[model samples]
Target: MTKNFDRLLEQSLDELSVQYKTLYHDSDIEGMKPLAHVDCTVLKIHGDYRDTRFRNITDELSSYPESVNELLNRVFDEYGLIVSVWSANGIPLYAM
Candidate 1:
């Protein structure tokens, strides 16, 4: 991946890590492993979480500000991977 793509992926991973930690305080290794695989650009949630899976995140980013979306989309469109997102639950969310 290009430097810009790497930076964007890192940023997205960081953001998800924080959010995952906050959402699942009692999360275990299994629960956390999926977080490492999430494709922030494509918003793909992959893992064995019962309640979590690769959820279509194309629109989810809309919740963020325009600037954030632009940056995220730029990276996602360029190098987003179609992978699984980590979830405290077992089911992985999928893109719609």
Candidate 2:
């Protein structure tokens, strides 16, 4: 399962990177960066530019037991963009 998840994460990150790059390019934002932090990996889009930040929690999915899903759901509902889950590779797993 972990291996499958890792592959998924890698794919997701690649997709997200392309998407973000397009967004930034279209917006013509020179210094814009999309920062994402999952449990173990930190992925930064335009990391050198240091403009925007995105916090996601997909990394915690494996650690959190099924019982905590309710609590996690609540957090997602309440925080909106404050918390998210990303895959180990820092691809967004869930966004709120």
Candidate 3:
């Protein structure tokens, strides 16, 4: 990826908490809340828990970085709350 895209991706990940809050507000479930903290792998993958896999996040890290995504998926498999993105039903659509 280009330097610009890298920076954009970094910014996107850094702002995940904010983006999550906004999305969660509109689709907040009874028992679901945004994650208070995230891990290094999660941050690196740039997975926003508040983002829905089924929806389009025009202003966020809508997609995962390839090199990181696969590796992150393994981490997710082990413990799927690193960057846990939930659906309306509270199912984790993707956790990296």
Candidate 4:
């Protein structure tokens, strides 16, 4: 179900006026370094829908993976402003 959701979200992202990058894996973390101020990046804070490592448990959300931790630190320290939104079944990652 979430796989299909990811696809739909991907489509919506495509329709957006800005460019976006999905940050869910090491490759994604590495790939984000080159993003200019114009780029829109999606930090899938919980995890990727397709990966088994995707965090959906209480313990998992309590501590992020190393890559995710680094990425989050970089994101929080580098970017002055951040925005996030999710609908329908969305339960925010931070609430856990």
Model 1 lDDT at residue 95? 34
lDDT of 3 by residue, 1-96 (tens): 111212344466567743422212212322334234333322323323344332235654465446445544644576554344557797879866
Candidate 4 lDDT by residue in tens digits, 1-96: 121215455567688755766666555666455546546676666657676657676886687668776766766678744444555688554421
Count: clashes, candidate 2: 6
List candidate 2 stretches off by more than 4 Å: 1-4, 18-71, 79-96
Return the top candidate by lDDT: 4
For candidate 1, the lDDT comes to: 0.37
Clashing pairs in 2: 57-84, 57-85, 57-86, 58-85, 58-86, 80-96
- CA lDDT of each prediction against the hidden true structure: 0.37, 0.36, 0.39, 0.59
List candidate 1 stretches off by more than 4 Å.
1-62, 86-96
Superior candidate under lDDT, 1 versus 4: 4
Which 10 successive residues of model 1 have the least lDDT summed?
Answer: 20-29
Off by over 4 Å in 3: 1-44, 47-60, 82-96
Task: Give the Cα error of residue 44 in candidate 2, in Å.
Answer: 20
Q: Distance (Å) between predicted and true CA of 84, model 3?
A: 9.2
Ten-residue region with minimum lDDT total, candidate 2 = 20-29
For model 4, the superposed segments whose C-alpha errors exceed 4 Å read: 1-9, 31-33, 84-96
Query: RMSD to native for every prediction?
Result: 13.9, 13.9, 14.3, 5.5
At residue 96, candidate 2 shows an lDDT of 52
